[model samples]
Target: MTFTLGPKATSAGYKLAAFDQIGSTNAEAMVRARDGESGPTWFATTEQTAGRGRRQRAWVAPRGNLASSILEVMDVSPAVAATLGFAAGLSLESALQKLSIEANMRRAGTEPLQFALKWPNDVLAERQKLAGILLEAEAVAGNRLAVVVGIGTNVVAAPEGTPTPATSLAALGVQVGAEELFKALAEAWVEFRGIWDNGRGFGEIRKLWLERAFGVGERVAIQTGTTKVEGTFDTIDDTGCLIVRTADGRRMPITAGEVYFGTAASVGAA
Candidate 1:
């Protein structure tokens, strides 16, 4: 099936550039922005190679997976622009829920899949990593910040022996296609992006995100560079930092790190 923007996205003047195969949707979007394409445009593909995740880790989407990125050029600070990734996570989680419910209805006794947003940029299905999000931004010529939020999902295949155990929708019996998920994602993005409203409505977004957050109130460990911090997952701060309540009653706001939970938290696996 071909990828197309949902009606809401098209009506809102958002454009889509779908690809059967691409090196990286995020890279393509940034290149377009640098070439004077100021947009709320989506660059999507079913197969992605040479993709980079957070911390410059290689992220390759096999032929049946989905890799998509949305580019937005705005006059906002990098800090403010970073919060858009939360909205991106919410959008994908909403889309996955919609598709899972539909898939369950067609089956005899299947339960709906549970999806949650991992801190910073990931979507987890039943606590297993199902998708990853990467946010990249650069300053453009007109003093505008071109931000690309890339989301890659495992629709049919999941890599083995990852830091966090990964799972695909097919493995979970959701039975969704890349094209179908992309359409639902485009529609969900319109709603969340409207609520984000160029970062002015981050307060509402933060509240909504916490409601569907994963690992909150759980024992957590984060590794940043050579240092490791162990604490209870408290909440996310106003600026979207992971707020870990460490020992001694201190709420530490971690800006960036690799996260671990449960037994993995103590072992420092990632």
Candidate 2:
């Protein structure tokens, strides 16, 4: 099938490269960045046979889902990369709201799912898995730097047999087309970049993320490669670690890991 660009995507400042299938959009973008591709470019694909998640787990892209990678060479420090993930998460939540699913669907229960932002990267809807963001960096030829930010939205179907519950916009009964969704996402990123570029700070970004955060201050469990810790869901640290308050009242900081909440917790893959 031929790939199509969003109606709002202009070819003037941005290049939209599409593929029918690829191993992974993020991987491809990283390769291109290493080869010196510069500034505000996007790589999207219909299907990713070998997609990847935070820990290199397989990220299956069934047909109709949105898989794209963004390349940028911002003059920001690497510390700022973490906040960009939250910024992207906020942007995705905005797009989902634009789709106008039921309020309950967006949040989940009484303390509904809040469309919270999972640390580093991952957007959660109703406490179930909804979307993920991956960031990779490479040093340029002239001591410059570039970052490839991969974003995957389950516009249709999700992978099966996963530990964390998976969900999609279609499954949630939202019928917005992928083209429209992509437009909203890209626009959101552009706006987010402006805030990030200025010294607007991560405090404001963290506040937005926490407002919709799922299980914040609630009991939670996190597994980071063989170590599992149960604690109260605290706020995300300045550097983007999800701070978890342990049983002994000590806050254990987590940089990257799988997190879940409740007895039937909906975990998100980092």
Q: List model 2 lDDT by residue over 143-208, tens digit each.
A: 666877888988888766766677887777666666667777776766665556632567777777
Model 2: CA > 4 A from native: 1-12, 101-114, 198-200, 264-270
Candidate 2 lDDT score at position 239: 72
Q: Root-mean-square deviation of each candidate, in angstroms? A: 1.0, 4.3
Candidate 2 lDDT: 0.73
- Model 1, 195-256: lDDT tens digits are 99999998999999999999889999999988898989999988999999989889999999
Runs off by more than 4 Å, candidate 1? none
**Alpha-carbon lDDT of model 1:** 0.94
Assess every candidate by TM-score. Answer: 0.98, 0.85
